[model samples]
Target: MSRRQRLMTLTRMLPSLLRILRRFRPYLRPQAPLLAGALLALLLSTAARLLEPWPLKLVIDRVVVATPSGGVSGIALIDALDPTTLLTLAAIALVGVIAVRGIASYFSTVGFALAGHRVLTEVRNDLYRHLQGLSLSFHDRAKTGELTLRIIGDIGMLKEVTVTAILPLLASSLVLVGMIAVMLWLNWQLALAALLPLPLLWLTTLHFGRRIQAVSREQRRREGAMAAKAAESMAAIRDIQALSLEKGFAESFCCEGNRDLREGVKAKRLAANLERTVDVLIGVASALVLWLGARLVLTGALTPGDLIVFLAYLKTAFRPVRELAKYTARLAKASAAGERVVDLLDEESDVQDRPDARPAPAFAGAVRFEQVTFAHTPGKPVLDRIDLALKPGERVAIVGPSGAGKSTLLSLLLRLHDPTEGRVLLDGVDIRTYRLASLRAQMSVVLSDSLLFAASIRDNIGYGAAGSDTGAEPGADEAAIIRAARLANAHDFIEALPNGYDTLVGERGVTLSSGQRQRIAIARAALRPSPILILDEPTTGLDRHNAQAVIQALEKLAQGRTVLMVTHDLDLAARADRILYLEAGRIREEGCHAELLAREGAYTALVRGRSGPPSPALSPAITRPIGADYAFGP
Candidate 1:
């Protein structure tokens, strides 16, 4: 960060500052009175401090020295007053000046702190709200720890500028202007000498501030990365332990940790050097003022009283400059933080609904994907020219060897990611034409592993009802939650727990078994009463009995609702009103289980390969776990 780089950084941040002001404008107008009062307090404090040295000058030249009577010199007009009386008056005035300044300073600090707090609260709320609406793709590519740092650490740093940087700079600038005006009035020659070092101080700020800013920026970036690394490692700790890769993860974390430490140290070092340079400059200015003022006084060109007053104001004035100079690094860090926040807020979401989009109509459970093609990355297609339709109450199972886009097709119905080309519709209306929330509300999804909050099991189960306790309704009524749980075969196990449904589950429901979590998730989806339901590998990873229990629960959930299940289990596929066999992103075969098997094509071969022989037809009891044998096929 040289001077040029610092300038560039400031230029870049100018827009962001305007952005901040725009955000605060709504809050600021309402609190203008408080802000005005705060500024007034600062002004009054500076006025009192300026009044302070005048009393000392009067005491020295008029009270103690008792200038040649009459209307003597510039200040001695009290001819009849005793020296003791005059001195006492001057002393009292000094104390009163100090008291007023202290009181005003207190008010200034409190007002700014409260105002900053209120404004920052609004900012955080808006940022968080925007974050919640961003598309899934945005979150998929973003690191949790980095986003957390932006929300917490970055915003916190910007707050420092509000409370510490801006106010202090304003007060310091005010003090500088008033003090120098008085100094020039006292004696122009001495004031000139005192102010000469200002240019040098500015130069010093640029010289040192750049290095500090550069190092600080690096430090902030490194810390964010380190936080992200730590969070990622902790999140995957179970996998690391199971795979015996803890040592590898620990080493990687340490490497980033060390980089962050070095950058932090470098930034601190630069800040220290900047502080010392400013301190030295302040000393030089003070010494220069004293040397010239003393010379003027002894030559009868100025009074001793005048010289003392000038020196006092000069010294006090330089203190603000010193404080300002010391804060360059701090201001830079704050600016960096603001920049990061602005960048995140500026991110555009591709999945947001159109401006004309309205609430989705009640779904009839009719779905259509017309010429849908998608690619997570361009040139490597996942689905090509996909076309499918299902009527109300239709139960469709999508089966394919791995990499056949079964899950992708299900995701399209929910619009987690829209197709790169083509359209998906619900009941003849393009789904994207409807508000995202309403569209999602019409479909209930039960993933193989759906997350539960770290709240009571009752709250977790209740959340499944879109817009109910979790989505729209009132308190998570215990009766309603239990009903859904019973429907999903989760009530029995939930009651077996010490606290039943009231038990607080750990993060992601880690305290419960895979089967228990799945059933709770199923109960949540079942509670949604949505016209459409999707179950992805609903019994994946479950033991035989749990799988049997889950299958039964699914059978009930599938009734009435138009259900789409993605699975490899021949037994599950047999239960669908119709099953589609997908391969290479296209529908290769579709019909009842018997029809597909009798044709003895792609669908028949897949069943035979996994089940070890071709059967007369698909059985309704062959539940088996398939691994990468499922991600993609040869």
Candidate 2:
């Protein structure tokens, strides 16, 4: 990115970061009194540190210096006082300063820690919410591990910068300014000599800062890639183990991890060199100040006391410069992290609600695809010029070979993706004209591979139903759920489990058989009772017995709902009100099961395992009856 662009991005993020911090206002506001007390202590400590050199000067110029008159009995001598008394007073002041500084440091550390955590919490929450609002295409392209790192690791890095670095740097800068002002007043020439190296120091810091930022950005990117690799490996562990690809995955993970480590080491090395350089510069500046002050004293242009004070301020002045060098790399690292977070937040969702869109009224589920065409990539259409229509309460089956756009057609209906051309309509209104949420709310979908979260069986069953009743409604009234489960042939096995309805399913329902999971998904979809239903190979994983049971449940579910089934099962397609035979990206042929069989086209060859056109006199069993509402003209 260009410097100006980076600056503008940072400027935009400042408001959001500030807003995140404000979430901790309640915690911070309550600690205001303590913070004020801490500030008072800090000021007192700074005053004490500044005053320490003045007293050393007083002792040197008065008590240690011989007076022209035989004895030193002036105000400076009085201020120096008896050795025992002076030691006692100095000790007391040192203790007081240390006590105040310690208290202030504690309060500041604790307060900022609370604020940082609260801000991180807000960041995570906002990121997660934004992720939810983002379109499916975004998720399809994003790595789970990388996104997780942004939500967890990146936010954690920001928390550290906020609590440990930002406030301390601010306080240190204040101390530096105070010391510089005092040093300049004492001896302008000596102060200038001490400050001479500052310009070089700043230049070096800027160079190192840029390098650190670049390295840190690379490190974070590699870290995210490593995380993505690890997550992908873990998610597909079964496949890896079955294929004996463990070593391959491990090598891949190691490669990413090593890249991150190399970048991190490079960043650390640069930071270390920057700090060492600052230290050497400060040492040289200190030596120069001392040498200059001694010359002024020898020339009677400066007092021994003044020289001591100048030396002390010189040390104090370099302290912040050294700190600035120390934290320059840290700031750079944080800037890179901030840039990434801002990038995610700035990303625009590809599918967004139209400003004039309205919620779809209750749908009777009449669906239409008017020459819909779509593709994940340009000029590579997955569904092309597909025109079809389903009247209210009609059941249609889409049958085709794999990669023939059967599933793609179903995705269009659900608006998982919008058609690149034409439109999908519901109840005669363009689907795009209706709010996405309202349009989706009218339909229920069950996929071949159903994912169940790690939750109670009851929760999973009631996943689609609103206002769940585990108590008010008798266990029997859960009969509806049980009945749905029974129809899916899942109730018998479920009842045999220890907790039955209350059993907690493991993550992704791994504890359940594939057939069981599919049945549960069907039960969930059935519970929705929407006017529209989508079953994408819903019985693919089931055994003959289980598949039969599921088909029976589905038959009831499809009764009054507009049903769209994407499947390769010819028998199931034969029972549909109408069958759409898809080839490549278009509907090559469509008709009632008997009529399509008579035509002896792709459907006939697919069903009879023939290489040519089908015979008209195919057996009645071979040409099953299409449902009552079936219609197919093209």
Q: Each prediction's Cα RMSD?
A: 4.3, 5.9
As a whole number from 0 to 100, the lDDT of residue 180 in candidate 1 is: 93
Question: Per-residue CA lDDT of candidate 2, range 1-634, in tens?
Answer: 4556555555654675565455435546655665676566556556656666655665566556533331243568555577566656656765676666667666656655665576567767887888877877788999999999888888788888877677677667667788888878877778889889988886777667667877877888888888898889888888999999999999988888888788878988998999999999888988988888889888877777787788777777677777767776677667667667767766677766789999778888899999899988999999999999999988899976779899888888887788899999888888888777777767888888888879877678777564222222222347677877776667888899999988899988999988788878877777665799998987775665666666766776677888899976666777788999998998988998889989989887877745433222222324564322222112
Candidate 1, residue 467: the lDDT equals: 55
Question: Per-residue lDDT of 48-100 in model 1, one digit per residue for the tens?
Answer: 98888877876777766544431144444654556688788878989999999
Q: Which lDDT value does model 2 have at 307?
A: 79
Where does candidate 1 clash, by residue pair? 402-631, 402-632, 403-631, 403-632, 467-471, 467-472, 468-472, 468-473
TM-score of every model versus the real structure: 0.91, 0.83
